[model samples]
Target: MERLSLNQITTDNWNMREAVEGCARASIPWIALWRHKVQQAGLAESKRYVRDAGLRVSSLCRGGMFPAATKSERQARIDDNRRAVEEAAELGTDVLVLVCGPAPDRNIDDARKMVEEGIEQLVPYAVSCGVRLGIEPLHPMYAAERSVINTLSQASDIAERYAANQVGVVVDVFHVWWDPDLYRQIARANGRILGFHVSDWIVPTPDLLMGRGMMGDGVIDIRRIRKAVDSAGYTGPIEVEIFNRSIWDAPGDEVLALMKERYTQHV
Candidate 1:
């Protein structure tokens, strides 16, 4: 049987409880929880609802954003990630995804260094909590705004620098589809592949940051990437993580239903 999961931000307006119930009703198998919504919906109760609904948690939404201007700020980011790891453990989630932080002042190299240092600092703590950290490579367009880890090679290098099996990368196809190095890097990441997130890229992407089409609605060759990951031995959930306001504004259940259908037919 195939497994399914969702990123909480896809249903931006839905509270965690609402999202869980909606997915459960749609018979989707899992969810990737966001920090704010976890707190808003109360972690304990959220876990209960998910378990009660017999839903699996593929991974937790995040624990990165490691770059900062000062020592205090950087330390604060590490502390926050520690908390995120603990939260993932509490929820019985196997992976905690990391959106490796962006530059504080547009210095990409500096941000990358900070991401390395921060992950090194947090790994021991995360290990203690029994939570695996999955670094995510955002699109190059996000190099300045969201993450410094923008390539599979870069992310794999960092993961190898720390723990081979304990730390890995979450490959979101929408972010890495244009990379000429994706196939080779995915091969390199063989055993270290942590999670796989899916969504399509619209040609005239309305919003550079948020416009994402459904699996079969745009130009992404999702099955090719899926085949690559599967060949590389990644038997993880293909998590749907679209961040479109137009989709969010619709009935949450409708979106989830479509997500399940597409996961079966297209993705």
Candidate 2:
């Protein structure tokens, strides 16, 4: 579990301070941050606090909801993403995970186009800011409300259009395990893979978005995928990003412990 990283959302109830301290006490050297939690602790101070706690920021939580009804609203979201880029700079994390939200005004094709175009605009700026944008392909369950980019192939399609240092595909197991071409696509990513997230999806998920299982608690072969990622030349952090409500409701310290144990034994 040395490469294990605890994503803040796994214990969403804890404030940024507790999350940092929890990782420190558990000896977990890395963590992934959510922007909202960072704002609650204040951006500059968040950076100082994480550094003081001796933790590395694996990736910043989010920065994409590109489809909007009007041009102004789209521009507003783009502006917000720019701020996300700046926040990532302050937090000392190069990768910013993006959940390209579904669009209300158009079909999947158009919504995806918006995502591609949106990231294209941010790529140059992200390069300048020294941040890499990670395009996360959420499960197809999120096709209508959460994200239009639902496959690693689609994300790779976009990432192939930009430099890997500026834009890369995020391999979150829960989202891509069902793809028949997952391993092939992982190989195709080669050096373009950014952050790798580990989590299991229950056989019959109670909640599409929030009901994620702990490692080894579900059917996914976590280590197999990790090996595929490793084989693809991605030596970065393998973050555990579980969004289950019960996990979040539990004590943060205990959650961290179990996450580490599961990562050690299962991942």
Candidate 3:
């Protein structure tokens, strides 16, 4: 059986800590944490709590936002990612997920080039820090402002371009559910898939950015995707990464309860 992990419910609210603790209480062994929250809680304290609670840090929530017009801006992101690599190593997570940034000038091709260059620049540093970089291909809707690497093939291509010192891709069903080449890309990803994210797509999608549904609450064939990913030799945890305001507004414990129930029964 694949284990479940709750990501960063601790910072969602003052009450969120209870929800996260409840998850630990439930014996869910893994969690992926956000950087800002970890900082706020104090890294040492956070790590200590997680370890004491008996949980494994799956992967850190971020690392790559590398497309910027100015050299200074780009370098700043590079520096940040380098630090992120070190942080992931300290957290003892298996990977650091990268959201390859978009072009400020709307040049998609240029943004892609920047992503490639950024990863190339950071590879050696990541290797030295004993951390792997997991490139997450965001949905095309986010292609303008958030991420430029919008396909698994693109992420895999970049991974192959760099020599094998732990560069891989994160496959999020919410992002790639619309892709025509998902299966082929999964095969291409092979063992390079270091992370897997799950969330459902709402019909009429009230908010393009938020409003993600829980498992089986929306239209995505998540189990099919899971099977494909498993076929590709990725037996890692299926991370639930929903950023829905409705859920966030609910009591954190209630939300966590619903999430765990649905994840167990449906996913």
Candidate 4:
């Protein structure tokens, strides 16, 4: 319970102020914020809400979408990432999760190189702003549209290219639970893990992007994965990041209650 952090996406209907207040009311010590919600609530107000509620900002979701057809477009993404770093700093969190986007064309290899280059460009700014960039690999199902980095090993490979303090990997169970080499890659991450997210991969997955279930309701061995992350020395918040539409449609308080119950039982 102490390590549990409610990610804003887990309560999709709630705005930043409501999410902050909800965390405070639930005695949740930490909250992982999304950039859109922060932008909606106004950054200063969102920061104030978290500070006043005494809830820590676990990590800002996200700051990477590096693939583009033109160099100018890629540079624009880098510029936005710098702004994201500033937002993370203002929100008082050191970690910024990066969901590296898919290929601009069909050349995934080129897109991957672009990802590395973008990270290289952003690292200095992130480091200056006291932020650590967390590269999060999405599930392979999202390879065509969401993210090209689809495996923990790939994410770790990118992170290893930079100083550990400047870049690291974010382990999200919904994305990596299917990998046979997950445990080995997790072990390889070691001190390079910046964040850990927990959500289940439901059997007969309904949607590739929004099929995540509560911790106890799916096929993932979440506790085992949590143990592996713990062993890897990530003592940070275990953020609950679910994208299911049904969960989002439910009442926020009820969703949070169920989340806590499932977290304790399964994760």
lDDT of the candidates, in the order given: 0.87, 0.91, 0.82, 0.93
**Which candidate has the highest TM-score of all?**
4
Range of the 10 consecutive residues with the lowest summed lDDT in candidate 4:
16-25
Off by over 4 Å in 2: none
The Cα RMSD of model 3 versus the native structure comes to 1.8
Which has the better lDDT: candidate 3, or candidate 4?
A: 4
Q: Residues 1-267, candidate 3, lDDT per residue (tens digit)?
A: 246777674226633245347667666677888888777777777777777777788889789889898999999999999988887888888599999988889688988998999999999999888888999999999988889899998899899876544798999998998999999999888888898888799887988877688888888888888888889888877777888877777876676677778887667
Q: After superposition, how far is residue 117 of candidate 4 from its true place, in Å?
A: 0.4
Models sorted by lDDT, best on top: 4, 2, 1, 3
Regions of model 3 farther than 4 Å from truth: 9-11, 14-19, 163-165
RMSD per candidate (Å) reads 1.1, 0.9, 1.8, 0.7
**lDDT per residue as tens, model 1, 57-175:** 88997899999999999999999999899899999896999998789996788888999999999999888888889999999898887898889989999999767667998889999
How many clashes (backbone atoms < 3 Å, residues ≥3 apart in a chain or on different chains) does model 1 have? Answer: 0
What TM-score would every model get versus the actual structure? 0.97, 0.98, 0.94, 0.99
Higher-TM-score candidate of 1 and 2: 2
lDDT score for residue 164 of model 4:
89
lDDT of 3 at 137: 94
For candidate 3, the clash count comes to: 0
Off by over 4 Å in 1: none
